[model samples]
Each structure stands twice: as C-alpha cells, then as structure tokens.
Target: MSSAYDMIPVLSCENIDKEYVTERTWNGKTKTIFKAVENISLYINEGETLGIVGESGSGKSTIGDILGNLKSQTRGKVFYRGQDVAEMDEESFRKYRKNVQFIFQDPKGSMNPYYSVLEIIGEPLKMLGITDDEEVIERKVLGIMDKVGLSKSVLNKRPDSLSGGQCQRVAIARALVVRPEIIICDEPVSALDVSVQAQILNLLKDLQEEMDIAYLFISHDIGVVNYISNRIVVMNKGHIVEMGRANVVFANPKDEYTRKLVECSFVN
Candidate 1:
C-alpha cells in the first residue's frame, strides 16, 4: 500500500503556457506576442518542496502567479487534488483559495502599511469565514505569530515600523493562519539580509516537517533552492530546461543553461 504522500499531487500543471500581447512601433504600430511561459508542466507531492530556479525574466514568477491562482494561463490546465481548478464552482474555488496561499518577494510591499500586525495576520482568517469573533481571531493570529518567531509586542505595530525580517514573519504568519496545504513563495527571502534569509528558510523547512505542507518555491538563486527543495526545476525563457533531485541537478547539470545557473550561483 502507498502512503497519503503518494496518493495524489497537491498541485499539478499540464502544458501550461502564458503569453502577453503588446503593441509596438518597431516598423509601424504592430502587435507583438511575448511568450512568458511555454509548455511547462510539474507537480508537487504532499509535504514536498518543488523549487523553480532561473534568472530574471525566466518566467519563474509567472509560473508562481499561475499556480497561486493570481493569474490565469493562456493555455493548459491547473489541478488541485486531481480536480481541474478552472472547472471548480464558486464554493470549491473559495475553498481552494483558502488552501493555496502566497508569499511574495517584497515582504514590506505585500502587506498593508496601515494595518496592524494582528490585522494583517488575522485578515485571511476572517476572509475565509473561519471566524468572526475578534477574540478567537486574535488568539489564532497570536498563536501563528509565535510559531513564526514573532513577539507579541509587535502585534500592535504596522509593517512599516518593523524590520524586513519581521515583516516577512508577519507574512508567513498570515499564510499559516489559514492552515494552507500549499504555499507559492515567490522569492520570499530575496529582499532580506543574508542572515535573515537563512532564518526564514529554516523556518519554512521546520513548518513543512511539522505541518506536512507543500511549497512551490520560486527563486533566481539555485543555492537557496537546493537548501530547501526536494526536487528542483530549472526554467529558461519560460521553458523547463532541466529538472531532477536537488543534489543530482546541482552535481551534474545536463543542460547548458542549468550549468551556467549553477556556476553563477556558486560565483555569487
């Protein structure tokens, strides 16, 4: 018999393609089509971290946004628990939204400056109809904040007043408040100091072990991905050029682009 981990994918993408149409004046006014993503397909198992790495403009973030339901793909299908997400009814989609959360690159900008830390973390709970009771919401928010290494003293403060790492903690706390099954982290630690990045990555690893949550971690840094990911997928100009176990890909990169990425990661 197989364990729950092997039963079904937490998230799946099939032949996903994304394109942007722009009007340009190259010769005269003409329409230009840019392929942000093309024929990309991957999946995340329960409690697994699938890391996507590439240089800037490689469509890593676009893939993250599509997976998180922040944007729609131009073609192909996204499935949650073997069910097509686009075909989900409103009620099912709402539940899917709660189960899939996002952690953005710019921690400070992702949050509202005017909202208190408590409010920022608790807002998702309220939006999901988890609870309307202020006391219960605060209790849950405080609990998650503690788990994310935040102090109660910062609860009443706005995100602007907190350090970069602290702001990211709040974001993590917010994502955890929903008890999400999958989180799409888009360069979640790139903006923070090197020391702080390690802390956040460690926290994510710990949480994954404890909660059995799956992560779609997107970043330009192969080293960071190698530290946290079980499997790694390398993207180039929207195409998946190389993918394999983190160690295997890092040790013996098969593609030229992947080799270059590995080289640059070590150099930097």
Candidate 2:
C-alpha cells in the first residue's frame, strides 16, 4: 500500500501566469503589463523539497506567493490535495490556510515588533482555533520552540532583542506551531551570516524529517538550493527554463540560462 508520500501532491500549480500592470511616465503616460510568471507548472510531494532558483527579479517570489495563496494567479489554477484552491469554500480555505504556511526572508520585518516571542509564535494556533487557554498555548509553543532549537529564556522577549538567526528560528517556530503540511520558504536564510545560514538549513532538514513536512524552498543561491532541494526548478524572467533532479540539473544544466546560472555560481 502507498503511504501519504506516494499519494497526491501536497501542493501544485498548472499553467500559472501572473501579470503586473504599471503606469510609466518615463517618456509619456503609458500602461505597461509585466508578466512576473508565465505558464509555470510544478508540484511538491509530501515530505519533499522543491527548490526554485533564479536571480533577483526572476519571479521566484511571485511563484511562491501564488503557491502560498498569498496572491492569486492572473491565469491557471492552484490545487491543494487535488482540490482547486479557487473553488474552495470559506471553511475549506481556512483549513488550507492552516495547512500551508509561508516563511518570509526578512524575519524582523515579517514579525510585529510589539509582540513577544510567545505571542508571535502562538498567533497561528490562536487563529486556527486551537485553544484559548494560555497554559495550553504556552505548552504547545514551548514544544515547538524546543524543536526549532530556540531557548525558552527568550520567550518573553521581543523580536528586536534577538539576533538574525534567532529571529529566523522564531519565524520557523511560528510556522511550525500550526503543524503545517507544506511551507513556502522565500529565501529563508538569505539575510543571515554564512555560519548561521548552515545552522538554519540543518534545522530545517531535521524538522522536515521529524515532521514529514514538504517545502517549496525559494532562493537565488544555486549552491544553497542544491544542498537542500530534492528537485530543482530553474526560472528565468518569468519562465521555467529548466527543471530536473537537483544533482542532475547542477551537473548538467540544459537551458542556456541554467548554464549561465551554474557558471555564475562557480564564479561567485
């Protein structure tokens, strides 16, 4: 018998296209339509990581936003567990929101400065109707904090008082508090020190194995993406130029853009 990992995809998109309309006054007043992502299709299996890599302004975050349901696609459909996200009822959508969470790159900016560590991490559980009891919430929050390797001493402290790595661990704890099935990690470790980046990456890997969660890991660093992803999707100017297993794509990129990216990774 097939397990959950072998069942339907945890999240997927079909023929996705996203457009941004802008008014430009460079020469004269004119409307410009920019395709941030075009005809992108991919899936993330249960407990698997799918890395999306591209340079800045390559539409990596645009695709992540659509998949996380933080934004809707201009065209095509998004599916969660084979159900159309657009067609879901409010109740279903709420469940989807609880099941799929997003981890933003800027940990400090993503969190409210006023809320303490406990409040920041426990917010999701409260929103998901977990419980109103403070003791229960604290217990669950502490458990997740430990899992993320965060110290309980910082529980009452604010985000401003934490280091970059600590802030990120808090962010991860917040996402994990909901026990989400899939996480859209948008350049999660891009803003940290190299040593801290490795620590966060290892923590994420350990958590994935422990919790059986799936990830759509979005990043611009080819080396970092290759280290963490099972498969890779190479995006270029709003298009998926190349895609394959992580090792295969890194060893032998097919598209010109992908080749350039591989070469640039070495040069950097």
Candidate 3:
C-alpha cells in the first residue's frame, strides 16, 4: 500500500504568512508591519487548475509570489511534491524552478523591449542551461509559438509591435517552452479586451489538456476564475474564507465575502 506521503499535492503550503515592515511616515521613527498574506494554506493537484480570487490588495498576488518562490513567506512551509522547499539543495531548487513557471499580468511589460519574439521565448532555455545550440533553441521556440497559435512571421518582431492578445500569446509560449509541471498565472488575461480574453482563456484550456500541466491561476474576477478552474479558493484580507469545487463554490458560497464577489460577478 502507498504511504500517505505519496499522495501529497504537487505544490502546497501550510500557514504561510508574508509581512512587510516599513516606516510609517518615512521619518524612520515610527514603523508599521503589513501582513500581505496571513495563515494561508492551499495546494494544487497534478494537472488541475486551482483558482484563487480576491480584490485588489486582498493578498492574492502575494500568495502567488510566495508559491512561485519569487518571494518567501515570513513563517510556514512550502512544499514541492511533498518535499520542503526550504531544505532543498541547490540542485533540487534548480529542479523545482525548472518545473514551476510564471505567466504575469502585463505581457508587454514582462518582456524586454529590445528582444525579438524568438529571443524572448527562447531566453528561459538558455537561463536554465537547457541547451546552447541556437538551432535547437529556435526549433523549440518555433514549436511552442505554433502551439500557442502564433505565426512564425512575427518571430523577429518585438513586444511593442504586437497587439495585447498577441503579446499574451507570446508570454504563454515563453512559459510553456520549458515544459513546466506547474504554471502560476497571475491575472494573465485581465489586461486584454473582452473578445481577446476568451481566446487566451481557450488557448490556456487547450494547452493544459495537451501538456498535462497544473495551474495556480490568481485573479480578482470571479467569472474568469470560475470559467478556468476545477477548484476555487476565495480570499479576503489574506485569508481563505471558502474553497471547494468551482461550481459548488459559486452556487453556494458560505462566506459573505465570497457571496459578494459572486454577486458582483453576476451583476457585471
């Protein structure tokens, strides 16, 4: 029989807290400690999309950064495949980084202005030492670009030259180039137009099915989150007030905050 340890989520955290200490009035005499995320625990199953929804300053992005390891929590443990991230050796951490990727909200701002689309997409391969051969990198970049529905004609173009939808597609291509096991998507489609948003969402859904990848999708829009996620986590003031299957959470939200969000989503 398999041990209980063998069934842990792909990525998870327990009672994680993130705090920032700053001067109250910039004079250095008075100080204030801000708790961006507090006592939050959550997980992402393999090949599943777990959506986290909250308003601005609700600490949703803070949790995403902590899970992505871009920022560390003040207290608590982060696990990857049931292994503690804090105790990982350099090689193990490198492996963790290779398996976890991020797709940010602003596609144009996330990319370098000078780099071509090919360069932007292939940069991760070089950073992770996946390959040094230009031909191999180009082939992989081209393949991923095609998979994300981008044409090869724009291979040498810069992010500034592309539309919002196209830039987001390039961002998706960059994240998928490494074939990561989990992707942290932080409001990835919120910057695009309504029509374009649906296209990108559909693309993400198709890619998830084809790649068998798990997603930690963080957004403030309940409607968007409900559409993409298999499970939902509702956050308010750095705490998860409710969590369950997507349909169930929306249909019967227990928390007042979650109900307000669901109501707002419907009204909008």
Candidate 4:
C-alpha cells in the first residue's frame, strides 16, 4: 500500500486546449468559434481523488470527456501513463480505453431503462471481449455488485425498478466491471440527496482505497468536493485558477472567484 507521500501521477494534461467552430447565418454567411477548454493542465495521481469544482459552463464536464478519450483535444496533449492519448492508434487505444472509465453525473443517463441490471453492467465487459469463461464473468460481476453494496436479488430487475441511489450504485458497478485503473466521475453524487450523497461518497472513497483506482471527480459543490477529494482544482471559464491539497485550498483560497465560491458554499 502506498502512503500519501508516495502518490504516483497516472494522467497528465499539459497546456490542453479545445474549441468548437460552427457556421452560422450572419448577413447570409458567418462563423462562430466557441472555446470549451482553454489551457487546462492538471495531473491525477494513482489511488488519489482529485476534485474539480466550478460552476456550469466552467469546462468541468469537458475535461472528463477529454481525459476519458471520449472526445479529442484540438490542441495540446493528454498523457495517460506518460503516453499521448492523441497519438494512440485504434489497437493501442483499445488497451487505454480499458484503463479509463467514466461515471456520468446522471445515473439514468448511464443506464438503460429497457435493459436489466445484468445486461447494463455486463454489456461493457462483453464489448471489451470478455467471453469463453461464463462462470468467471459471473463471479467478476457478482463481486463488483457486492463491492457497490448491490445485491444479486436486484440484478434481474430493470433500472426503473431501483431507487435513484440504487441506480447510481448499478452505474458504479457497471464502471467497475471493466477493472479500470481510473474513473472520471463527472459529479457522481450531485443528483442525489444529502444522506444518499454521503453514502455514495463513502462508497467511492472506499472503492478507491480497495481497488487502487484514481478519480477525477468534477463538481460545483465545494462542500462535497472537500468531503471526498484529496486534491482540489478550482476552474473558471475553462481555466484552472487554483490547484492544491483540498484542505489547504479550502482554508486559504487565493483566487477571488474561488473566494466568492467559498462564500456561496454551504456553511451549515
């Protein structure tokens, strides 16, 4: 087991930039350029949770998409285990895709209402070519279900039958089924109630400890970020203004926007 001081960075984003361009009708012809992420750089260490907090349109979710290799970066490089993600060929990227997974903010968005929990959780594994060993796959699936506090009894049920929290657990189990080294959680707990949020947060923290997985947790709630993050990165308009230990950044915010965010934080 590695201690806090022995943290190893697994993902590095250097001078990362992205923009969206579209053609519009302005005087019969026009063009628009919208910047989604601007020079955002941060490193996520192995077995550590790095929480990113920013309001809406602050490029929090875009960072998750970029790092998960779901979306390409227009400029700069995203290094996963010191290899440029942009440079990965289809064959090499297949392996990299296995090492990284994403947990979206909306539980329903991640799951399919028409599919049973088993299918939803097992589909990704199947797509990644987990076959010829049915018994082993069942064991792995059940093990992950147990890890997320999900019971086998609910495995046959459709997503609609489960509560929101249970649905989130199923989503989490789905992500864990792939045995990814890192999980990019795009505000996984924000949509749940406070009590349920704590349960999920504890579940994630425990899982990170047990599985040796790193997390890039994105959220707007500083309180939630502080409750779960090892490090905090404050973003504003696609730029990271502050990055440091969670406690240190919360206790002493250097950026005025961060201070305003702290002022708006839940004091209760």
TM-score, every prediction? 0.95, 0.95, 0.95, 0.93
lDDT (Cα atoms) of all candidates against the true structure: 0.92, 0.93, 0.93, 0.87
Residue-level error in angstroms, candidate 2, position 223? 0.8
What digit string (tens of lDDT, one per residue) describes model 2 on residues 1-268? 4885668998999999998877676776657888899999999998999999999999999999998888889999999999999999998888899999989999999999999999999998888887888999999999999999999999999999999999999999999998999999999999999999999999999999999999999999998999999999999899999989999998888899999888877634
TM-score of 2: 0.95
Model 4 clash count equals 0
Question: Candidate 4, residues 1-268: lDDT per residue as tens digits?
Answer: 6774666468878888988876677675548878988998889988888999999999989998998878888898899877888788887688788888888888987787899888888888888885637677777888899999998999789988898899899989988999898999998998999899999999998998899999999999999888888999999998999999999998999999999999987654
Which portions of model 1 miss their true places by more than 4 Å? 1-6, 24-30
- How far is each candidate from the true structure, as Cα RMSD in Å? 2.3, 2.6, 2.2, 2.3
When summed lDDT is taken over every stretch of 10 residues in candidate 3, the lowest stretch is 1-10
Expressed as tens digits, the lDDT of each residue in 1-268 for candidate 3 is 4553566688999999998986576666547888888999998988899999999988999998999899988999999998999999999898899899999999999999999999999999999989989999999999999999999999999999999999999999999999999999999999999999999999999999999999999998888999999999999998889999999999888899888888877634
lDDT of 3: 0.93
Clash numbers, per candidate: 0, 0, 0, 0
RMSD of 1: 2.3
Q: Which candidate would rank higher by lDDT, 1 or 3?
A: 3
